[model samples]
Target: MIGRRLLVAAAAAGAGWVARAAWGTVPALGASRSAIRPYAAGSPRYRDNRFHNSEPSSSLPSGSQSGLAKAFLTRGATGRPRRAIPLAAPLAPTAAGELAVTWLGHATALIEIDGRRVLTDPVWSDRVSPSAVLGPARMHPMPMALEDLPTIDAVVVSHDHYDHLDQSTVVRLARTQSTIFVVPVGVGAHLRRWGVPADRVVELDWDESTEVAGLTLTCTEARHFSGRGLARDTTLWASWVIAGPRRTVFFGGDSGYTTRFADIGRRYGPFDVTLLPVGAYDERWPDIHMNPEEAVRVHLDVDGGLLIPIHWATFNLAFHPWDEPITRLLDAAADAGVTMSVPMVGQRIDGVRPPEQKPWWQGLA
Candidate 1:
């Protein structure tokens, strides 16, 4: 009896240690509940002590949680590529001319305009979850190492989702780079807690604009929710317009199709290029993520010159086949007479005149 009791205590102590390690290492929830209340006051979207989407949106459908879980476990397993994904060693941005974009997989990309580089939604972690030991791991290696990235003029964060805002990556950038971090309103709290200098962090609400390295960055509205933990919408989500003196580009962080694109086009139309999300969508949550066809429509609605699809090919967040998003996007672009570029993971695409469309993702299935 004594030996059995000792074994049970030892097992309990081991389980406690594992749980503590998993939960404690996640970055702090950043801002206290009281701190974010002030930002919510004047904002039109803020109501009843939480931020709401422009269109009534739901992350998951009613009574679909169980179905989603079962689908994910069964169908999600088939979403991975059967062969190794190719990676392109990024060319030096200095040689890519004034306006260019290098897709760094997932939603991360480096946009160079007028000699200044803006990194959008930079996530360099191996996994996109609170615990490193558990969660969705990368489908392919990063095209370029985080430390090897060229000096960036600015860093734009779309939202506070783990896949978008990685704490480990943020901490490293905070220590290594002097570049300014432009984020949605309440994400500044996370940066502050993660040791980013207050002066280096610039938080903006929708429709607000800030100047960084002689470029205009306007925060635009997006239909999504934000939270690193249980408390949701404490931070705002946004799309962005990056305009230089000579060229302009739009970065759609992650959003559903909305007429807001037309409004944006009227105010800041005819962009040289637009980076839009094109994956991780399902009918169950149609209002939150746009399908590939919808993405093309938003591109056209924005009066965009060149369309580059993002948010796919890096993580298996959805049950769709790995190549389906881009495949469907190609068909839609061909149908719409819209110019599109499907650069490899690290290939640099010229903003002014993108390379001819290539079926690079073929045979990798």
Candidate 2:
């Protein structure tokens, strides 16, 4: 009876600690900002264009996006299914290694590439919603604490979606690490709103390249929209090409299938590792999010030596079974004879010698 009581007390204390971190009261990073970006408000990427400044229902301009159909695609997706979420921990830590990556669940990943630690879409909130009071709360605790992450080189933001561009997380990162922030154009506004130092923020357009702490960061193309409130297209959406001396990685921030993948391959092809989005897909809106099969095709298209599936298993932004993503992706990958790395949250896969990844989600219910 005494032991049971002590155990209960310990559990309560642990819960309290997690709650405090989730409330955004602590620093998650502590690195200096050396690769900050400088962009103007009147730049073409952030200029008021017809697609974005027009009606609420319209797709942003892109290579394949055109005409009346593009406008319709922007409105919304069909068959909006209800999605469930995991009760995730708010504090996840970076593992120890030469090149390590810890999945803070969902589309957020902490990557240590070429001796430089980087964060990609790091969202630690319980839910991915503008209004914290209403949305999908996590199903599991964050694997490690944000403060526990090591000094970072840069924080790469893919877009302004609630799931990717979380304000609270940004604030904490800003306070802790003088981390240089690399994001798509216009996303700098959101970071600025969150108290990020203007000198520490770098925003780029498609096909543009910048250098961050000896790493080459190229803002590549992606087929998606961006908006925090109803103001879509004010910000540009993108994937990224992170080139280190030892290896080059393609972060498929989020997008539907596009010929740009081939272009990226030609420009930054034969990536040692490709982190692609393989979930949150539907036939109704096939132009925005790529399904599992398309993700596999993109893996091959990028000429990736090893494929790592991200953007799933963290949040259920779309209506589908929680395991539907990994299941479909694995089957399709098997059919295509593609190699893959399916790491668990907080698990790191090395680029030079990444572990032989297994389908750890096999038993996930």
Candidate 3:
């Protein structure tokens, strides 16, 4: 009788495990390709049922899969910091300033431009994956609670990647805030599935512009891919141009070294500040994510003034040392004679009167 009871308990445990995994996958996966295809079909980038980049790009180098697999096996804990990462309290500005930025972590940031507040790729979840218990977990807690964020005029999403477009964060924001979601074409399907009102979601294709709170948000080209499951490139990815009356800001969501930045610069040249990705880059996938040196090139290509780096220091998504990206970025920026501000998480930097760079990640790494 005891043996039979043990077997029964094992069966119950297996069932519970399956149920938990399904719970995370069903809603978190968002919309399928069929649901997204209808909205994306109208985009010029969409061809043969998939969105294509302006230039041909590969997610991984040819025949590098085996090498990448081996590298992952021997990666160890090189991507984690030795000690707790420092965090700074977000500045509570009485009103939106002319030009300022608060780097929450990773690709998430709050851009204050011309007296309007815009949140970019805000991911407040612990893990970024279809399964709640799996994926790249946060290295440090959020510096501040999401509920404490000031009134947001709009939330801009770069793509549908798990790290960039989190399902839980979108749902929570939809329930709590009245801010509209501005995303690339077909991304609105995911928001609608997450219970966000259709009217609150604005979808735009490349070169398309929308007005929000007296600011013009233009979807620009980015050399990247997008997907949440087996079907890839169902949705479009893009960088953004946030222009106001007096100042403009460029948001390099996530892209590789592409000459398209020069085109964007000519159209919207001389931005006051730029927020660019500087992490999760690997030689095997050089066409998708830019290295630190390449990031400096992009800053110049876009004619950016004050550079604020993002997409690092929050999660371990690459094999390099925890602080390698920032170290390399600082050296490259210095060599290029580029002005930059490396803010601690939640620390705000005013573009009009920028502060000096502080090496906060030095001792912790």
Candidate 4:
């Protein structure tokens, strides 16, 4: 009896230690029973008189109704059958150019715009769930490993979704390069928790603009919500505008339709390139994920010059077939005459140069 009890005690102690270690590490290995706590959504407050801060307040809540309402107004994902689409690799980018965009699968992109190289919403993990064992697994392998990425000057995060602001990816980035982390408000807490130095993290509220390495980084408004675990919207989310001496580009992290795009355009219009979300949309949650048509509308709203579609491929976050998003985008863009560039994963598309004319994704259809 004594020996048995000792063995049980030892097992309990070991379990406790494992739990502690898991909490300390990120990309949580196991699931927690409790729901994630909510953070600020967006705010109308301003700090230091720089810009208006719109936050995600617990005051408002979101549910299935949100996406359903959006889908009702417009058609849901209904178009063509999907085909097995294998991703292309190593879309090499030249160092000399006004802007070079490589879609690293899903919404992750490396943007070398106007001499400054920036990474957007990087998710280099196999799954976008709280645990590694489950959730939306990557449809294909990452075109290039994170270690292979060129020296990035800055990392711009859109929000704190498991897919968007991945903890494992953040840890690797922190280990690889001490890039400037420009993120939305309240995201600093997550980065701080993960051991990223506060100074390296620049938290911006909506409409707030900051200058890093002589480049102007502005947090524009995005019509979206946030939450990692059970916790809902506590942190704020936003699109961003990167203004360089020669040209300007906008990175729409994730959003529904809102008038803020026009506002961003009026303030910083005629962008040379606009990187916008074009997938993960459904009738259940239309407001959160912008369909290709809505993405095109927002593209025009921001007064973007050329559009580069993202947030599709890599992972099946929504129920729609993997190829539906791009097909819809192509149709909408052609109707509107909005110029677009669609590059494969790890393919560096010169947003300025005419993209290699190929429907590589057609292979999937």
Best by lDDT: 3
Model 3 residue pairs with clashes: none
> What is residue 358's positional error in candidate 2, in angstroms?
3.5
RMSD of 3: 1.7
Q: Order the candidates by TM-score, highest first — what do you get?
A: 3, 1, 4, 2
Mark the regions of model 1 whose C-alpha exceeds 4 Å error after superposition.
1-17, 20-24
Model 3: residues >4 Å from true position, as ranges? 1-15, 62-70
Which candidate do you rate higher for lDDT, 1 or 3?
Answer: 3
Which regions in candidate 4 have their CA more than 4 angstroms from the true location? 1-84, 91-96
lDDT string for model 3 (93-149, tens) is 879999999999999999999999999999999998888776789999998898998
Please provide, for model 2 over 1-365, each residue's C-alpha lDDT reduced to its tens digit, 9 standing for 90 to 100: 99999999999998886675455322221111211113334455444441121112224335533553564445342212233332323332443234555667777887777777778998887777754545555655678777877888888988878888777788888988888999887678667666788899888888888899888999988877776554456667889898888778888988888877888898888888789998877665577788999999898888987788888876655656667887888899999998887777767676668777665665555
Q: What lDDT would each prediction earn against the true structure?
A: 0.87, 0.72, 0.92, 0.75
lDDT per residue (tens digit) for residues 1-365 in model 1:
99999999999998987886498355644566566667656677778878898888898988988988888778845778988889888986444358999999989999999988999999998888877666788999998888988888899999988899988888888777899999988888788878899899998999999999999999998888887777888778999999999999999999888888888988887799999999998888888899999999989988998899899988899888889998899899989998888889998998787777778799876
lDDT of 4 by residue, 1-365 (tens): 99999999999999876675455334442122121122233345323321222433221235655665464445443322355555667754446357778888778988877777888998988888766655667877898989988878889999888889888888889999979899887777787677788789988877788887667899888877776665555566789999888888899988876766888999988898898898877665555678899999999988988899988877765667668888889999999999998887778787777666688877554
Overlapping backbone residue pairs in candidate 4 total: 22
- Assess candidate 2 and give its TM-score to the true structure: 0.77
| Residue 75 lDDT, candidate 4, scale 0-100 | 42
In order, how many clashes per candidate?
Answer: 0, 25, 0, 22
RMSD of each: 2.4, 10.3, 1.7, 6.8
